[model samples]
Each structure stands twice: as C-alpha cells, then as structure tokens.
Target chain A: MITVRCFATVREILGCETRTLPPSSTPQLASDILRIVAGARTTDLPKPLLVAINCEHASLTSPVKDGDEIAFFPPVSGG
Target chain B: MIIRLQTADFDPEREAQALDVKGAGARVSFVGTVRDTAQDRRIEALEIEHYPEMTRAELARIGTAAQTTHDLLEVLIIHRYGRLQSHERIVLVTVWSAHRAGAFAGCQAIVDALKTRAPFWKKEISPEGAVWVPGQTPQDLR
Candidate 1:
C-alpha cells in the first residue's frame, strides 16, 4: 500500500486529507500517485504544486515504493 | 542548536536570555509578526500548517548550514503554527557568536533559508476570504 497525504489548499480541493492505495499497475513514482489522486481534477491542482516523500521535500519524478508515504500540497508560505 | 515548533506563543526576551552563552560577545535575534493587512485587504488571521517531521528536519538543516558557514556559539529557532491573530508573533530566530558580524549574518541566513526551505503553509484570513499564500520553494529544491 502507498500512503498518500494532502495538505493546505490541495486538501481542501481534493476533500481528502489522507488515502491509501493498494499497488495496482504499480504506481512507480510520485507523479503517478498524483495522477491517481487528481483523477478528473487535474486542472484544479496548483500550477507549481509541491510533493514530498516520507516527509522530505521531493519532486513528482521521485521513485516510490510499497508502504512509502507521499504528500501533495501547494507551495509553502511560512516564515 | 535548539528548534521548537509550538502552538503556544513565546517571549523573545526570555528565549534570548535562556540561551547558554559562554564566549559569545554578541547576540542577534529576529521576531516575525503577522501583519494586520495584506495588499489592501484587512487580514483577520493567519492559518499555518506544516508537515511535522519534515519541519523539524528542515529547520535542523538550515541551522546546521548557518553554523557551518559562520563562527557561531548557539542557534535557536521557534516557529508557531495554527491560527494566529494579526500582530501576533509568528517566528523567532536567535543566534549567538563571538562577534557582531557573525551573529548578524548567521541570524539573517537562518531567517532567509527558513522563509523558502521550511515545509510550512500559511493561509491569510481576510475580510474577503481565506487564501493561501502563493509562495513556493525554488525549482531546484522542489
């Protein structure tokens, strides 16, 4: 299973805070996971949406593995 | 190095005085407070959200990098999250060093890095509505 989390506006738009996806067709990368989560709402995602794997800031192309945690969110604005 | 991610407010004077300074001849501190307005909109509050584990790690990275680049004695970073009213304190950064230059530069470097590198999101609640700040990490870091 791949653990997926969303935060900030992304969470608000998706209406989901967390989700679990069983490995199917092997979603091999962070972008793949995003595609699944986005579904038909691709256009709603942030233009420069951010991704993180296992709590470290990462890119969409970062590889994914079973049981890994993935996060999607808008750009950070904190100081 | 000391890093704190808390929902409670902190006193800058108390935090600065609490640092264990030995040979430090200078101490520099920075406090960030929420503004009452953004652009022309009257801001009501700021809602801050963060990835817990990542926030700490990124802060540590920034603190350590600042220390590496300067001659420092101590580093302390306190960042508050959750709903905050306008004019409330949002963050504090303090650094102690042997000279004024190192202390000043180190503190500035930490604050600059924190602004872009930390995994924190802020939403401004104004009279109009709540909106997320459209800031992102640089392309290389993302």
Candidate 2:
C-alpha cells in the first residue's frame, strides 16, 4: 500500500489527513494522487499546489513505489 | 553553523551576539517579517506550514551552497512555524564574513535560495479571505 498525505488548503478541502491506496493503483506519481483526491472533492482544487514524496519536493512525473508516502501543500504565504 | 525551527519569536540582538565571534569583520543579517498588508489587502495573520524534514534539509543545502559560493565565516538561519500575526518577525538569516561584500552577497544568496527551494509553505489569513503564496518552480531558480 502507498500512503497519501494532504496539507494546507488541500487538507481542508478533502477533510482527511491521510489515506492509503492499493499498491496496484495506477497513476502512481505524486501528482496523480492529487488528481485522484481533487476528483473526489466537491470544489475545484486550487492551482499552484505542491507535491512531495518521502518529504522531498517532487515533480508530477516522479515515480512512486509501494509504501511510499506523499504529501501535498499549497503555496506558502509566510514571510 | 546554527539552524533552528522554532515557534517562539527570536531577538535579533541575541542572534547577532551569538553568531559574532573572532575573525569576522562584517556581519549581514536579514529578517523577514509578516507584513500587515499585501498588495493593499490587509492581512490578519499567517499560518505557516512545512514538510519538516525537507524544509530543514533544503535550508541546510542552501546554507552550504552559500558558503561554497562566497568567502564566509559563519551562517545561521532560524524560522518560526505555527500562527504568526502581522508585523511579527518570521525568519532571520545571519551571515558573517571578513568583508562587507562577501557578507552581503552570501546573505542575499542564502535567502534567495531558501525562497526558491525550501519546502516551507505559508497561508495568509485576511478579513477578505485566505490565500497561499505561489509555489516557486524550477524556473524560478537563479
């Protein structure tokens, strides 16, 4: 299984902190999980969101393995 | 070499005193504070979030890169997390060098690299609404 984590606005929108997907799931990149979560959302997901795999910022095409942990975060407004 | 991820506010005087030591002729410091307004919109507060491990690693990498690119003596970076109000200091970057030019260049380069590469995130809360700062992409790297 792969663990998917959401943060910031995405977490608020999804209302779930973490979810697990089957290892055989298709579209296994960090961005793919976003598309999946966004698809399930009632509202449109915000643009310019960021994705990370195993605590490292990752591109949309970055591959994910079984048991990988992924996180999504929106742009930072901090100083 | 000091790195801190803290929730408590920091004092510039304390940081300067701690980083200042023998062999350093110049010291450059940059403090980023939460502004009361952004683009004319009044901000009430800011909620900062970060991928913990990633943020630390990224900041350290930036510090190391700065040291390599410039002649420097020391570097210290401290950032606060959690809720922060307007006009409060959010981040502090300190660099010490033998010359003013090195100190200035090194400090600027470290901050710039952190902005572009660090995984820390921020969300502004205002009376009007909340907005996230746009994420920096690879193209933003200098």
Which stretches of model 1 miss by more than 4 angstroms? A24-27
Clash pairs of candidate 2?
A76-B122, A77-B122
* iRMS, all models: 1.2, 2.8
Per-prediction TM-score, please? 0.94, 0.84
Going through the candidates in order, their DockQ values are: 0.71, 0.39
Candidate 1: residue B83 Cα off by (Å): 1.0
lDDT of 1 by residue, A1-79 (tens): 8999998888999998999999766549888888999888967988788888888788989998888899998887767
Which candidate leads the pack in lDDT?
A: 1
Model 2: per-residue Cα lDDT at residue B116: 69
Task: Write one digit per residue (lDDT tens) for candidate 2, span B16-35.
Answer: 89654678999999999998
lDDT of each: 0.89, 0.78
